[model samples]
Target: MTDTSERPRADLRRAPERYLSRPEEGIETRHAFSFSGHYDPKNTHFGALLACNEETLAAGAGFDEHRHRDTEILTWVVEGALAHRDSDGHAGVVRPGMVQHLSAGSGVSHTERNIGGAEGPVRFVQMWLQPDAFDAEPAYGLRRVDPAQGGLTLLASGMARDEDGEALRLRRSDAALWLVRAGAWQPLPELPSAPFRYAHLTAGSVGYRTVPGPQGGGRSMAPGDSVRITGAAFADPVAGEDGAELLLWEMHSPVSYG
Candidate 1:
């Protein structure tokens, strides 16, 4: 059952505080929410998001075929390349600056592996979102982005405002994913107002602050850090000296499995 009895107003989750899982040699994962054997009833989900995982796979290692249904899976590669193959006859190589989305409508089976020719270990962040409708046709989408370009780029969305052909389409209308790659000391764009918002730092550091709320204190966020905002807005984050890459989610509501 979906847990909605208790929820935080807003909070920061640091990198080291995440749940660590090393299912096999050369494969490491850090989960932001309850997953696999790390279950937290109060922390089962935030907004429509169910899982936010940071994964690293050594050369020639990867996840075997797995099945999923009624979930929207999004992946962002941090370094190296990820090779994907699925039951729907879709195959591709996703690298940094690319967005990969898989919609497990009714059901789908897939496998992900670090490319054998990668220079080193492959690292990526993968997130799962609950879909609004079930048993629809499965689909796949891939898009390459120029992170150096200024401003927030719409990566995936199901909202009416994003009906344009720019973003990968999702099956849920209450959520959207955005990306920002800022230069050193650059101010980020204003975030979209929503009941629930989550920001994950995929690369570099930033000075961030939540606005119009008790958790308004300025904070520094390193790679793997995340901020969860509920019924509040966030001030524009400033990139650190080394710059920053962020993946932000704007959701109007939490997940409901009725």
Candidate 2:
């Protein structure tokens, strides 16, 4: 059972405020949270989630090797293919419907590029989460999920309470990631009740409302929009005419920078 002692709060985050970055000619990134050179102390993080970035790269464009440590990085491809290579000897081409997970436990360096000789551009949404413990060995994982499988799919989980082996594992035992692809005007699956929940619309549009009361009113969400819910349960969202693809994070704990 969820604790409802505190009043439920729902906050909508429009996509227009996402910090835009064009570090290179063919690479463009829109960050939902404060990122490099874009600092917003009040919007730093929600729960264990540190960064949510939507990136697009032109063919033959890529990011050079970069270092990361003690961060759980998850990437979901929306269009085209992305080539990934890391110092851990892991290499793969991630495409739509695939989830790529990189646990930079202690430290690791990697490079990401838009696969050449294929599509026009590669677009993906990447999220970063704070791990429960730090300084472990680095790891990597990849899983393919079928959007048409029906209902919400558990793409990854680190929650101790979850025993689903199908989900790609995470390093934090208090966080989980879910994905859903809904048809036009289809009702979405019930959202998991958690102390902190963050929902991002990756494709199409959706209409959502808070449960019990109308704190947020019946609102429509466009692609790239996100909502942060604290101590609240929301009514299931319904897809718009073009259908919708959504990613949700269920976080039981807040960020601990220990």
Full-model lDDT, candidate 1 = 0.87
Q: RMSD of model 1, in Å?
A: 2.3
What's the CA error at residue 7 for candidate 2, in Å? 2.7
Candidate 2 regions with alpha-carbon error over 4 angstroms = 1-6, 147-149, 214-216
> Each model's TM-score, in the order given?
0.93, 0.93
Task: Give lDDT per model, in order.
Answer: 0.87, 0.87
**C-alpha lDDT (0 to 100) for residue 90 of candidate 1:** 97
- Clashes found in each candidate (C-alpha, N, C closer than 3 A): 0, 0
lDDT of 2 at 186: 96
lDDT of 2 by residue, 1-258 (tens): 122237665677788878999999999999998898989887888988999999999988999999999999999999999999999999999999999999999999999999968659999999999998789999999989865367688988997666656788899998999997788999887778888888999999988776555455687889899988887645657999999888999988888853
- Position 135, candidate 2: lDDT: 97
- Worst 10 contiguous positions by lDDT, candidate 2: 1-10
